[model samples]
Target: MNILRDVSKLVCKTDRRALASLLKYAETGLKPQYVCKGHMSLASQTDQNEDLDKLYRMVEVEVRGNDPAVLKSYSWFTTTAAMELGITVGECWTPRKANHERLTLLKSVHIYKKHRVQYEIRTYFRFMQFLRLTGSTANTFLEYIQRNLPEGVAMKVTKVEITAIPSHIKTHSEPQQLELPATVEERNL
Candidate 1:
């Protein structure tokens, strides 16, 4: 997902004014602080200018939820998985019948017509890696998600199904085996 590059863009490219202020402070050896000027804080100023409240809402943080870190980590996992799958990361995704929040741990990947089961399996394992990286237990993550689900919400299965193609010849077609000649010159034909 190139986390470093994306984060760098957010920090360096997007926040140019903040960068300039910091640079000015560094050059002058004076703490350059933006006057409140009715803006709560410099950070808030930048956020307000960019409509961060709306952007943060897109992140879908549940105010009632205790650990905001879970939501943040879930967002990271979704982005990483989407990048690995070569799909554009959206504000949300539908893993199955469940919503984005329900599928945060990605207990199962939904199968579709013409979809590659192998790729889905790889993505699932890689998401497990992300879960571990985010200080979550890989084995218990699904159980935890299940426990946290709201009342009356049924958990949907995410297993990918694969079917094997038969190698047998068709019964209606007569099997014609090719015969090779013993001589090299004859084999060429």
Candidate 2:
């Protein structure tokens, strides 16, 4: 029994280390064996770099996949686009089921204007890119759609879920209302 316990502990330790190494790769795109600089074959280093590149894309997809806000944006945009084309849309996963899933993706996007096709949009984060394309904060996602969408298209969002998504796109609009109203004492000053 003591021997069994020792062996079990060893197995558990090895498993933990393995998990740690994978997580380290996921976070920093580093491979465990290649961490220390030493004599390694050029082929091996190339293989490790390729593996790291795949891991980084997977990590990015995983992060964006599990984000509810990102999923919501995806759903909103896909649903809106589908509605415009008279295509039916349904939830890919329930809120409960999504907790265990690695990715939440829209299965279909049927566009009937300027292009007519029914197919899968490659990534779940496509709408996140669309929001960025519109030069809109996530807070103003609906507003951006409202302004940029074709003449008859529209989208609506609830009062909540207005948290910002970081964007670097520049728009031509001028700044508005940065100055604060003067207080009585401040006015005297």
TM-score of each: 0.19, 0.19
lDDT: worst 10-residue window of model 1: 52-61
Give the whole-model CA lDDT for all candidates, comma-separated. 0.37, 0.38
Candidate 2: residue 43 Cα off by (Å): 56
Top-scoring candidate (lDDT): 2
Model 1 TM-score on a 0 to 1 scale: 0.19
Q: What lDDT, from 0 to 1, does candidate 2 have?
A: 0.38
Clashes per candidate, residues 3 or more apart or on different chains: 0, 0
Candidate 1, residues 48-137, lDDT tens digits: the string is 554211111111212112233454455465456535644333344323222223222333467444433231111111121121111122
